[model samples]
Target: DQQVKQNSPSLSVQEGRISILNCDYTNSMFDYFLWYKKYPAEGPTFLISISSIKDKNEDGRFTVFLNKSAKHLSLHIVPSQPGDSAVYFCAANLQGGSEKLVFGKGTKLTVNP
Candidate 1:
């Protein structure tokens, strides 16, 4: 069973609009959640993260929300820009275990100008 899943394979948004990506997980042991953005021919870069203790975390135009009870999470990007187009991966890991990250397949976001 895939512990982490991004049901939507892709999403499209107009420039200066909002982009939302969804993720789900079956593992309840995950205490930390993260969103990473990946570009073509490059590795994924950390975008934002949230601890299980909090429901939301934000940084500039990027925000991440976790619904622990539902085993779901989402990443919201306000005023999406062209450069924001990329594959986004939702990752989760135990707070103090082996520090390994489990990632979803990824959601490709296209920010059209």
Candidate 2:
């Protein structure tokens, strides 16, 4: 019963610093929150999204924050580069029709240039 959880599989940053990705949820009926970004094999892409009423959501350098009473959600990458190395997935869904997303087995973000 892993509603969602990303207990830091990996995270390393240096190039320009600033890169935090964390997510945890026990499924309080998940209210639409997503963040996906992958490279290698290619798949996850969506990046940034928040809609549990809104706690915060950015786009530029990517930024997504949601703390629906501590269900937790985070993804902020601001200067970190090196092409912002891959793997970063945190998702949740339950708002519209078909948006079934519940993934969190990623965090591998290595950006050390």
Candidate 3:
């Protein structure tokens, strides 16, 4: 099965603090991973991505780490802000030719000021 999973359904954090979200996968064929941030009534926007070949990738306040051996991944948001309060979906794709993506149910991140 091409099932990608996010075990935690939600997370909450105080503003200016760190927020972490976790995900897992059962399929080893997955080659590319992505994190998408979505707001109410809006489509998810591409946040960051890491190739299966890399263990870590970072962007400004966001960082993603992939552990291929464990079939796990995580996203860390530093100094979380109120604007960051939304649903985060961890997704994966086969990469190369097809565009089919598997997404988790999503984690609702609440940032309190």
Candidate 4:
């Protein structure tokens, strides 16, 4: 079973608009949440992350929000640009010791300029 899930397979947004990617998890033990962006042939690169203790974290135009009670998290990109288009994967893991990470199917985001 997948501990993490991204309900939407893809999302499209106009340039300068906002793109939101959603994720949900069935495991309550997850203490860390991470979002990664992958290009066509390159590896997934770390984008933004949020700790279970915090409700939100932001890096430049990217922001990650975690809702523990709902076991859900989301990544928000404001002023979404063409360069921001990629496959976004949401991942979760135990912060302290577990090297294991659970990842979602990934959401393909298309930014139209």
What's model 3's lDDT at 31?
92
Q: What CA root-mean-square deviation does each model show from the true structure?
A: 1.1, 11.2, 1.3, 1.0
Q: Write the per-residue lDDT of candidate 3 for residues 1-113, one digit (tens) a residue.
A: 43898877889899999999999999899999999999999999999999999999999999999999999999999989999999999998885653588898889999999
Query: For residues 1-113, what per-residue lDDT tens digits would candidate 2 score against the true structure?
Result: 78899999999989988999999999889898888789997777877788999899888888888988899989899989989899998988876664587788988999999
Relative to the true structure, candidate 1 has a C-alpha RMSD (angstroms) of 1.1
TM-score of 4: 0.96
Question: Estimated TM-score per prediction?
Answer: 0.96, 0.32, 0.94, 0.96
Candidate 1 residue lDDT tens string, 1-113 = 89999999999999999999999999999989889999999999989989999999989999898999999999999989999999999999986763588999999999999
Ten consecutive residues with minimal summed lDDT in candidate 1? 92-101
Stretches of candidate 2 above 4 Å error? 15-28, 32-51, 54-62, 65-74, 80-113
Judge candidate 4 against the unseen true structure and give its global Cα lDDT, from 0 to 1: 0.94
Instruction: In angstroms, give how far residue 78 of model 3 lies from its true place.
Output: 0.3
Model 1 earns a TM-score of: 0.96
**Model 3: worst 10 consecutive residues (lDDT sum):** 93-102
lDDT of 3 at 64: 99
Clashing pairs in 2: none
